[model samples]
Target: MPPTDGPYDGPPAGDRVLALDLGTSSARALVLSADDASPVPGALARHKIAPTYGTGGSATIDLHAYVEGLLGCLDELQHNGHLDGITAIVLSSQWHSIVALDNDGGALTPLITWADTRSVEPRLDPAFDEHAFHARTGAWLHRLYWPRRIPWLLSEVSAVSFAGLPDLVIERLTGDRVTSVSIASGTGSLDLATGEYDAEALAIAGVKPDRLPAIVPSGWTGVLAASYARRWPGLVGVPVHPPTGDGAASNVGSGGYDESTAAVTVGTSAAVRVVHPIDQAPELPWELWRYRVDDQRAVTGMAFSAAGNLHAWLTNVLQLDEAHQEPTDVEIGSSRVIAIPFQAGTRPPETVPGGSGVYFGLSFDDDAADLLAASLQGASLEIDRGLRMLDTLFGRELEVVLGGGGIDASAWWRRCLTATFARPTDVCAEAEVGARGAAAVALGLAPVPGGEHLKPAAPEVERIELLRPRYTILRDLAVQAAQELTRYTSG
Candidate 1:
C-alpha cells in the first residue's frame, strides 16, 4: 500500500519523524527534525498518567488505559498534522513491566511494573545456581524481573500468554508478535550471549516459547497495522520500529552511546549506565545487570529503586514551599542531618531493599530546609556509590552525563553530585532524551549538538573538605545499616 498524504494544512514536512517515549508517570510525543535533532515547533504532546498503587509494593497500570493514553498522544500529533513527512514512528518505553494476555489479545492482568515487590516474598530455591542464572540471563533473581514475577503471576491467573509491556504495545501497533532485544534483555529471561530466551529461565518461569514474542534487534522495524492506518491516514504506511527499553534509549539520547560517557538518570528512581560492546561486559558482578542495546552492544548499570520519589515524598511530608526552598551554599553545607535515602529500595552490589530511610545528626535545631538538604545529599551519595561501582566494573573513568527531570531541576543536587563523586558531570541537554533516542535509532544518529556537556559547577571548597571526611562516616554507617537490615530480615 502507498503511504497516505492527507489534505490537512500541516507544518511543512522536512525530514521530520514521530517519536514516542512512554514513561512511568507520563506519555510524551515529539515531532523531531532528524536533520538537526530538534523538535518541530508546536508538535509536542504530553499527558500525566500513573500506576494504581496497591499494598505490598504492588505498582500496576491498566493495559487498556496505557494504550489509550499512547493513542491519545498520537491523536494529538495527528490533530496538529505533525505526522506529515515523517520517516518513521519510533518508541522508547519503561522497562521490566509484565502483562498477561487472553486468547483475543485482551489483558488478563494489570501491567506489573518493576516497582512491584510481591515477588520478593518468594524465596529462590537454594539448589538454584543464582550465579549461573545471572551469568546466563544478565539479570538477578529479583522481584523486578520475570524469574519470580512470572511464577507469582501464574498463581493468580490462568492467562494463556505473557509478555512485557513493550511487546504488547508493538503488537498492537504493527500486528507483529515481536520484542526488541533491548526489552527482552531486561526481562531476566534472555540469554545475554545469545539473543534468545534462556531455557533455564523459561523453565523457572513455567512459561513456554509460545508465551513470548520473537526477539528482534533494537532497530528492527515493521509496517503499521492496516486497521490503525485507516484511522490515522498520515501514519498509514510509515515504518514503525520495534520498541526499545528506555534505559538504552536514554543512553543514546544523552550521548552515552559508548564507554567514554556514563549516564545517570533520576526520575521516580535512579540508574547509572554505560553502553558498550558485549566484549566489555565485566568479570561477572552478581549485582550489575547487563542488558543488550542491540545484538552487538550492551548496557551495564545499576538501578537504584529509590531516588526522586523519596525527594517528592519528603517535600510533601514537610509541607515545603518555594519560599523556604532556597538551595544556598549555607543550606547545602550547614545541614549536618545526614540521611540514608533508600526509602524505596536499593539495587546491585546489594540486590536487596535498603529496608528503610535513616537520618543521623537530626537535632532540635534542624528545620525543614536542613531535612531537605540532607535528603538531597543522601541521594547524591547513593549515585556516587553506583558510579564508583560502574567505574570499577568497566575499568574506566567514565564522564557523567546526567539526565532525568528531578536532577535537571536542581542545581544544588548537581553540585552535590559533583562534590560527592569527585568526577566530571554534566546535565543532559534534551530533557526528554528517551524520545530523542528512539528517534535517533529509527532515523539514524542525529546528535543534539552541544547536548552532552553541562560543565560541572565549581565545588565549594569548604563543603568538599567537610564531605570528604563525612562521606566515609556516612558510607560506613550506611553499610552497617544495610548489614543490620539483612541480618534482621534473615533472622
Candidate 2:
C-alpha cells in the first residue's frame, strides 16, 4: 500500500490531524493544527459512550458501541463541515483491554477490559517465572492485564479462536492485524528487552505464533476502512497512526516525555510517571513502562488505580451524607478523617479487586461532611505516597508536570493538590491532551510550511499552587496507613 502523505514535516495553518482518545467513560476526538499551542474548543469533539461493567470481573463493552460513537460524531462534525483541511487520524486507547474475534471479522467475545479481573489465577502459571517475565516484559503481573485474560479466552472459548485485542480492532478497521509498540508494551506479553511478545508468556497462553498483531512504530501507516469512513461522511481516507497509551500521551502532551520532566495525572486513576534509563529496567516495585511512540526514546511509568477515583468517592460522600452541595479546602483540616483508597487493583504484585475505602479515624464531634473533607486530604496524601515511590524508583524527587480530569476543573481539588505537593503543579490548559498529543504525533509527521516543520507546543504552566505540608502529622499518618496496607497485602 502506498503511504498516505500530507505533512511529514510541519503543516501550514488549518492543516489538521484528528486525534481520537478511547477512554473508559467516554470517547473524545480532537482536531489539532501545528499552528497553535492552546486548544480551540471549537476544533474539538466528544461523545459519551459508556462501557457496561460486570461486577464479576468481566468489564466488557460492545465493539460496535465504540465504533458507532466514533463514526457518528465524526459524521456530525463533517456534515457540519468541520473537517475541511484535516489530513490524518491518530488514536490513543486505554491499556489492557482485549477484544476477541473469529476469522470472519465477527466479535466472538466481550471487550475484556483493563477493569475486568475475571479469568485470573491466584498464583503465577508454572510456566511463568516472575523475575524472568519482568526481565522480558518490564511489566508487573496481575489478572487485569492481557497476560491472564488472553489465556482465559483460549481455554474458555474453545469454539471460537481469535487473536489478541489490538489485532482484532486493527484488523476490523484496516483488514490487517497490526499493533503499535506503544500499546503492545502495556500488555503483559511484550518483552521489554526486545520489544516483542515474550516467547515464554505466549507459549503458556496456548496462543498461536501468528495470533498476535505485528508490532510497528506508532506512526506507521495502515489502511483505514473506507466503508466506515463513508458512514462518517467526510472521514474517507483518514490516516490512522497509533499513539501510545493515554498515560504516555498525556505525559508527552504535558511535556513530560523526557527525563527532565515528570507528571502526576489524577483521573479515574492516579499515576506518577518518569522518564528513566530503559536499559537499566530497574526491578522496582512500581510498573516499568515503555514510552517510545517511535524508536527514538523510551520511559518508565507507575500507575495508581486510586488517584482520581478516590476523590470521586469523596465527592459522593460530600453530596449524600454531609449536606455540602460543594466541597471546600477549609473543610479539610476541620474534617480530620482518613480514607483508605483501594478502589481498583493495586498496580503491582497484585491486580485483584477488593480494596475499597476504609475510614481510619473519626469522632462524634466530626460531621459526615467533615470526614468527607478529611478523606480528600488523605487522598492527596496518598498521591504523595505514590509520588514518593515513583521518586524512589527513579532514585530522585522528580519535577512535577501535572494534568488530568480531576484538576482540570474543580477549584477545590486544585487547591488540595497545590497544598499537598509543596510544589506548584503545572496544569496543561489544553483539556484533552491525550488526543491532542496524538494529533501532535500526526503534526510531527506532517509536512511543514516553507519546507520547515513545527513542534508540539511545549506545555505551558497555566497555574501553580505550592502545597507545602501544613500538617506533617496528617501526611505522615497517611503514609503509615499506606505502608500498613502494603505490608498486609505483601504478607
Candidate 3:
C-alpha cells in the first residue's frame, strides 16, 4: 500500500473534483479546483505497481493487484478526508491495454499492457489491407492494439469478453461495463467515422461485437457501485466519469487543446499530439493515429516506443553515477555517436520487425556519459521527427507544450528537446498533468497557464539541425539491419 498525503488547503471541498490517474507504473489520486482544474494543495495520494516481465517480451500485471492498487489510492484519500466535497471523479489512464473477462465480468487473464511485444508481426492475415484499416480505424495492424493481441490471447485462454484496463476499472467502480470513445479509439478496433467498433477489425481479432464492452461517449458518468459506495460513503452519489486516454488528457492539461498547439509527452514512452475539432481534422496520416478527446474532437499524433525507458536502460547498462545520470548542459552533437534508441521495438512509420537498440560510431574514448548523451539525442531526434510530421499536416508551426515526469525532472532534457525542435517550448510545471487533464475534461475548463518557457539559442538549434541528416541515415541502416536479422533468425 502506498502512503497518502495532504488535506492542506485551497478551494472549498464542495468545489473540488477528484482526478484519478492510472499510469503505466502507478496510480494517483488528486483533488483539483473545479473552477480552473488546478490541483488542490496537499490533496494527493499514490500507489506504485510492478508489472511482470518475461524473457519472451511478455509484460503483464496481475489484474487483482493492479485494481487493488487503484482502490488503495482511493482508500488513503478517503481516510485522509481528501474525498470530501468532490463534485465528480474523472480518470486518465494509459492507452492500448487489454484483458480478458469471463462471462460474469471477472478477469480471465492478466492485464496485457502496451509495452508487451509477445504478439509479433505477421499475426495479421495477408489479405488484410493495413492502409485502409489505418485510415478507417486511425490505427495500424500493430501488436500494441486488439487486432493482434486478442487473437494471441485466445490461442492460450478462453474468454467471453474483452476490455481495456479503464473499462475494467469502470466496471469495478460503477458496475457499468462501458468504455469511453476516447479509450475505445486506442484499441485499433474502433471506426472513427461511426464512433463504434469496426466490423472488419472485429473479424481480424476473431471477436464479435457482443464480446466487447459497450462504447460510451467521453464524460459519460455513473455512480459508484454498491460495494464501493459503502466503502466510501461520501463518494456514493458522486458521478464517476469514464476514463479518457492519458495522452489526450495530458494535452488538455498542458494547455494544448486545439489545432494550433502540440503536446509532447515523454514518460515510459514518447508521443506528439494535437487535438482538433472532428469536422476540421485533416485526412488520417498513415504514420500517425487519431483518437478522440470526446465526441466533438480528435487527437492526432505519432507515438515512439522509446523515450524515458531508453534513457533508463542506458543508465542501468552503463552504471552511471548520480551526477552523470542527471543530464546537464552538453554541447549539441558533441557525443559523435549515433544511437538507434529502440531498447523497445519501433512504433508506426518505422515498425522494424525485430528491432533492437544500436549504437553506431562508438569509439574507444567514449565513456558512459558519452553513450548516455548520444542516447538522449537519439530519443530527441525521434520526437523531432514526429513533431515535423505534425507540423507538415497542420501546414504551419504549432506551439509546443511539454509535459510528463521526464520533462518535469530534467532541465537538460528540456533543453535538448527545445533545441531539437528549434522552437520555443512551454514546460508544464504541474507534476501530475494527466490527473489535472482529467479534471479539466470533467469541469469543461480551458488550459491553465504558468510554466517555464524555453527558447533555444540559434547556435544550439543550428548544431542540432546539422546532425539530423546523419541521424536519419544511421536510423535507416539500423532498421535494415534489424529486418535482415529477423529473417535470418526465423529461418
Candidate 4:
C-alpha cells in the first residue's frame, strides 16, 4: 500500500476515531471522541469468532471468516451512523499469529494463533545459540514465534508469503502488505538494535525479505483502497494507522505507559508489561521478553500460557456451579491441596516441555471447591513469580494496574492475586481497554482515568508469605519430573 501524503492533522472538535480490537475470540469496533479519547455511547459493534482445534496441537481460525466478521462490525456501525465525522481508524490485534498467503494475497493456510503448540519441539540448526538469538530478537526460540512455526508449517504446506493476521486485515482494507514494528517485534525475527528483521533469524525460518510485509513505523498511516472505499463510502479518505499489538495497547489503556507502572492483564492467557524508552530499557532478561510498542517505546514482560483457560477447564471438570466458581469465603492458602497449574504447558524461565497440570496432596475429604481454590492459588503464584522478577529488574517496587475480562468477572481471583503480590493494585474500570488504547495511540493522548484501588490485607499477605516456599518446592519437583518424563519417553 502507498503512504498517505502527509501526517494527519489533529481531529477537529466533535470528530471521532473508529477503533477495532481483534482478539482471540471476538472482533469489536467502537467509536471514541477525539477530544478526550472516550468511547461514544451506543456506537459499538461486536462479532464472535471460534477457532478450530485439533488433536495434533493445532489451533486456527479461517482467514476469510475472521475478516468478514470484522467487516460485518463496520457494516453495523455504519448502519447506526457511527461512521459520521470519523477522522481515522486504528486497530489492536493479538500478537504472534501467522498466516501463509499465496501470490494473489489470498490465504493458503488458516491463521495459526499463539495457543497452537504444533511446533513445541521444533528442530533447529546445531549452530543456533538460543541466548544470542533472544538478545537480538527480544524473543525466545519458542513455538509461539515465527522461527519455529515457519519451518514447521513449510514442511506441511506450501506458500509464497507469510504475514500475521493483522497484516492480512490491513492489506484487505488498504491494498498494502505492511506491518508495524510493534507487531514485527513479537515475531522472533526483528532485531532490536536495527529496528528491522534480522537476516540470520530470517535465514533460520527459511524466508526471504521480499516474502514478508514491509516494516512500517507505529504512527504510519494509509488510506483505504478504492474497492474498500466504495464498500464503506463514509471512510473514503480516513487515515488508518498500522495495528498495535494488543498487549502494548492494553498497557497504554490501563495507565501503564512508563516504568513506574506495570500492567497485568488476564484474559484467555495472562501477561505483565512495563513500557520504557527503547534506548533506556534494561538489559534483556531470559525470563522476560521485550517487544516494541512503536519505534520509540518497548514493552518488557513475561506471559503465562494458562490463566482464565485453566480456570475454565478446572471448573468444568469439577462440575462447579456458578456459586462455587466464585467462592467468596475461601481463605487464601487455606486449602491442603497444592496444584502446579500448567494446563496449557509453560513459558519462559519456568518452561516445562509437554508439562501438564498436576494436583498434589488430594485426599478423600477434598471437594470441588477445595480443588478450584487450590488451582487459582497455583496460577496466582505463577504470576507472582514474574512480578518479583520485574521488581528486581527495576530495583524498586512498581505500581500494578490490573485489567481483562477474567479479573472483572472474579472477585475471588483478584483476592488471590493481591495476596500473592502483597502490594496495592489498581483495577481499570474501562471495559474496552484495547480499543481505547488504539485510539489513544492514533490521537497522541495520555492514559484515561483508572478505577478501584485494592490493598492487600495484612493477614492474607502473611499467609501467602508462608505458603510460597511450599509452592516453590512443589514447582521445582514438578519441573524435574516433567524433564525426566520427556527423556524417558523419547528414549
Give the residue spans of candidate 2 off by over 4 A. 1-14, 36-38, 122-128, 159-169, 232-234, 276-292, 317-326, 329-334, 445-491
Judging by TM-score, tell me the better candidate of 1 and 4: 4
Clashing residue pairs for model 4: 1-176
TM-score of decoy 3: 0.94
lDDT of 1 by residue, 194-259 (tens): 888998888778789778878766546676788886568888767777777898888888777887
Q: Give the alpha-carbon lDDT of every model.
A: 0.76, 0.60, 0.83, 0.84
What TM-score goes with each of the models? 0.90, 0.82, 0.94, 0.95
Error of 3 at 71 (Å): 0.7
Question: In model 3, which regions exceed 4 Å deviation?
Answer: 1-14, 120-127, 353-355
lDDT of model 3, residue 205 = 89
RMSD of each: 4.2, 6.4, 4.6, 2.1
Clashes of each: 0, 16, 0, 1
**What is the C-alpha lDDT profile of model 4 across 218-265, one tens digit per residue?**
657988988876668899888899898998988888778889888888
Candidate 1 lands at a TM-score of: 0.90
lDDT for model 3: 0.83
lDDT of 2 by residue, 1-491 (tens): 43333325444666676667777777776667646433545866677855676666567777777766766666666766777676666777777777666765577786666767677553445565676666567665566556676777766664244444445555666676677677777777777666677786676555754766678764466656766655554556656675567776766666566665566677777666765455664564534444444444455666667756666666675566334523653533344455555555456653334455556567787765566565556566656666666677667666676677775655565556555655555666655667765565545532111111112121211111112243345435544566677679769
Ranking by TM-score: 4, 3, 1, 2
Which candidate leads in lDDT?
4
lDDT for 375 (candidate 1): 80
| Candidate 4 minimal-lDDT segment of 10 residues | 1-10
